[model samples]
Target: MVSFIPSKQLTNPQTVLPEQLVEALAHETPLAFQNVEPFRRKSALADGSQKFLLRNQEGKPVAVAHWASPYAPHSVREAIARVNSAKQAVGASLAPHILGPVGHGNVQGSSFGVFQYQYPLSENKFFWPVQRAQITPHLLQFLQEVARVTQVPVPTSEIETKFAAPLQHLSLMEEVPGEIRTAAAQALCRLERGLWAPRYVLMHGDFWKGNVLLTQKQPPEPKFVLIDWAGSKVQGYAIFDLIRMAASFKVKPKRLGENVAAHCQILGCDIRDAKSYLLAAGGHFALNLGCFPLERFVCMMQASVKDLDKALAATEVN
Candidate 1:
């Protein structure tokens, strides 16, 4: 447990951490900064929140903190939800241990939280798409563990609302290509008929390489820690996570389909049809990833549809 002291020199205008956030951290968490300056990172988007890497007096990295803008209550809410969702899934074994919220002042203005981990995240080397053949199996194992803990029976109405409705909406969008829209329409019809609606598992929702942190630990010891659980769901299509991971590699569409197929086998999911997997994965992403702009979402959906088409065509050729 580290003791914190808010230094006057560290409270200047150019400081990345807000004064309120600093106070919250001093009072709420056991992080010590004192004369140490935090390494700050602004959000890639205009989300008006910033992340800070706090260090101890000895210059050892200790905790990560997030400070949200006054207007971004949703960001704060998502932060809280992310912690709760991770805890509900299987506690700190699969994620960074939650240090709890800095203060309950999210709605009033800014919000803050801190997370501490023993091993530093492998920030640089985890993403090696060229070696996907070796990396994908570990990712599949992580996904299977997540599903094993979080799987539950989802009702049809929930499926329609969560997946089919978003797909129907996408199908009507003019910005989306005809092929993608047609595929979306077909997927919606299948949902209505109860196809691709069963065997729901908790989806990481954004299971890309960036969100996955590999510790410097050797193989046989636990190394993977999944972060950013804002989009996790108790009842979701596991194919969504599988496809998202494949897409992050920027693999060709047919290759992505093959990866998902192989991953599905590992998870014991029976989704073999390329079109069926595409529909379910696409619909799940379209519905839950509201952080993406409509245009961006449409573009992703178009690309995904094309990839799945290639995958299906390749399957037919074989």
Candidate 2:
């Protein structure tokens, strides 16, 4: 069992940088710095790890260090090792950019890579900490990987069942007191046909906005590169990632469709695919809204219904 330290202890050293972090950064980056600072955090810290800013040997700002909390859950501790593993996998399989451990310990058992600084945003917010983006190609591989490890039903049926609850939740919201809405009108089109995520994927199940990084382009148009995989699981659905990816763009000031496109590309499933494999993703995300008011949840579903109707109409006309 991983030794436990209370989370309060992890956040106690508010100012002085961690020696472990300094050493870890030295191994990851080329910059040289002599000092460090505190990195602002959010209730945003997932998995109980604390974040900090640090300087390198050359006196330059280097990285955001994450140290594990005391009394950290075993899952959180295991996440740290798993995140390193995911980084190594992505690094070996995809190259050009590099990975740096920004937060340490159990913030969802992962690290946010440096490449995430380029996410699309109209303004800076206090709690934004994503470290990467999911491009089309990367997304497809992720889909297959998630299918590989889940070890459940086939992609199509599994995705449908997983998404059933969320779809119904949204469906219920779409239906008027006595009216049959388009989503409810159809027999859950995706449900009948089912989606295509692999039966199991070596996946990052808890992958949320905070865990992603989008890769940037040559001119750097606020693009991104994804990082962090401490909560990555192997048995998730491709749809869940898309839902989270799409949601990440929710706060963005522009180009909602285009952003969803990026996520679509990653999954290799166009938005129009009725039998898409992302039902699991949709349901997974609905679960994320548990903290919100029930009324707000209905509003979100209504919007989803409108979007789904438009997408279907377009597909049918095309």
Candidate 3:
């Protein structure tokens, strides 16, 4: 029997940054030093990684800074390494320039890591082109290059273990109706069975439109820059990244299959084999939904389940 924990206690508490930390950031970086007010933005994680838009003396946004609560030194290290690796693999023009660590100190009894940041073009109202003709080739190039540097052999056991978390969660969720739970379980089982013969590559674990930044509105060449490397993994399914990216832009599932086909052609994967990867990727999102705070939990959960159902039907996976 799976015992339920209260959702409120399971959620990570929000951490407010001190004026001292903001002042310390200005001193550490090449920004106009002052008691400038920082604008807060919503972060993907609830782990108190506070993202703030720091403005200069003229009140122009200069840089963004992410201050991590609970002091994840390893995460900080990985972020630096991944950013540098990606920069080398792609180029400085297409990757966020990490300005290095800023400051680390205690905030509200929790230790934190203050890190420098980059101003992405997306912040200035830039978005990717909706047309596949313009979007596909550039995205493909970026994904291929990123995979080239970061690919590593991962054990099948590790992949299976990672995929199982969601299934376990769904089995224990009393709130899920019986039919939905049964269908989801069956889909997960099919996915697990299908993924036994796996292919691995380095993945921008959370690859989506939001993390991709465009440098120009009009193009002779549209410069694409990737940001937020903390969630990256060396041995990950490439198809997972592709699926997430398509979903991020609200591409229809049928259209997503077309995108998937193009991705497979570039990476040399059989299109027929993409189903398991898609389902497994959906499972990851579905399982993680409950872990998020209540505000985003239901909406994200519904979207994930919808994606799973679409993929299952599109692929005709029993």
lDDT of each: 0.58, 0.43, 0.52
Q: What would the per-residue lDDT of candidate 3 be over residues 1-318, giving only the tens digit for each residue?
A: 111111112122443456555555544555443223343443455444555555555555555655554555345445756656655544454444223345544444444444433433333334434333466566755565555544444466765565555555554555655644564466456546763344566667666655654544555665555667766655555576766666765556665655566555555545544554544454555565545554454344456456645754675542
Across 118-167, the per-residue lDDT of candidate 2 in tens digits comes to 23322235433332232433443453443333335445545445555555
User: To one decimal, what is the Cα RMSD in angstroms of model 3 from the true structure?
Assistant: 9.6
Better lDDT candidate (1, 2): 1
List pairs with backbone clashes in candidate 3: none
RMSD of each: 4.6, 8.4, 9.6
Question: Taking the candidates one at a time, how many backbone clashes does each contain?
Answer: 0, 62, 0
Ranking by lDDT: 1, 3, 2
Where does candidate 2 stray beyond 4 Å? Answer: 1-33, 41-47, 57-59, 71-77, 80-223, 230-234, 239-279, 286-305, 311-318
Which ranges in model 1 have alpha carbons more than 4 Å from their true place?
1-20, 35-47, 90-108, 117-135, 217-222, 250-259, 262-291, 307-318
State the displacement of the C-alpha of residue 45, model 2, in Å, after optimal TM-score superposition: 6.7
TM-score of each: 0.74, 0.51, 0.62
